[model samples]
Target: MAVKLNTPIKLVLFDVDGVMTDGTIYMAESGEFCKAFNVKDGLAIELLRAHEIKSGVISGKASPALTNRCQKLGFDIIETGCKHKLPKLEQICTNFNVTADAIAFCGDDVLDLPIMERCGLSVAPADAHQLVLEQADWVSAYKGGSGMVRDFVDTLLLSQSNIGLKEIYQPLLRKIALDDLTGVEQ
Candidate 1:
């Protein structure tokens, strides 16, 4: 079944390292960095795109690996090297005209709290920092880089049940057309 959000969960932002990857920074002899991401998490993001909910990535660090992943996942917005995520997230909300309360952010560290507090739904992985887990509205059953994102997305999809009857599935192009009706310029 597909999940459709009228407004409550219009956008979902994710933290790259701890939330998507295992939070390991592998530095090779040539100063190359490598990060391993869960395939299930990638599929979850793509599923959201199919369901009319846009997804974004706001990470505190930058890496070619992260960029490649975002591109492959068809992320609606991607911002890296942002230690302070709230500010960048605010800009994204403004551009898309997404209300603060309609955004859901998933993170796994203390640095993610600022934005987490502002968003309507705050999600944390089971292995998230103590403070982060404390602040989250929902904590995943799975650990980061281990299908945790899939777990979060599943719960979000399930929550749409009480949101009223609507379409169960929306094709990508139709979803994009509906999104334009909102103040989401592009």
Candidate 2:
């Protein structure tokens, strides 16, 4: 049997360390925290926004760098240092007034299981742990922080032909009627 994303997701949730940052942490001599992020994933977030999909970041550990990155990305929800994610998931659901079935979550480890189990669509990176890969409804071909989110975003957007992504672009195109088109051609 094959598993697929049956319903279109309105919200996208991601884990920070593995899904967005390649699961690596670098501590400088001065104790500054840093993580490497893939540019492709950042573009994926832009694509999601183009299609009017809400997005957020949920991480077990907190980092100022991660917070700034998410803010710059325009993610709607930012939950950091959350060891217990289920409650946070509930809070998101409530805030968005969206059902669990309209959410997609991509995770790479054990801590992500509970919410993944409850979400309508669950994804894991190719390099995720054995247990997480086994439980995932969809395992991405790309590894974490290496275009995994891009792969998922592409798949999700491709699956929505009827929704017409062109329509999403039209509004911005109109604004560019020789005016607010500062970044329209992009």
Winning candidate number (TM-score): 2
* Candidate 1 Cα deviation (angstroms), residue 180: 27
Model 1 ranges with Cα > 4 A deviation: 1-7, 162-186
lDDT of 2 by residue, 51-148 (tens): 78999988998988888889888798999999889999999999999988899999999999999999998889999988889889888888899999
**Per-model lDDT:** 0.84, 0.85
For model 2, the run of ten residues with the poorest summed lDDT: 177-186
How far out, in Å, is residue 42 in model 1? 0.7
Model 1 gets an lDDT of 0.84
What TM value does model 1 have? Answer: 0.83
Q: Considering summed lDDT, which 10 consecutive residues are worst modelled in model 1?
A: 163-172
For each candidate in turn, the TM-score is 0.83, 0.87
Q: After best superposition, candidate 1 residue 26: deviation in angstroms?
A: 1.3
lDDT of 1 at 42: 84
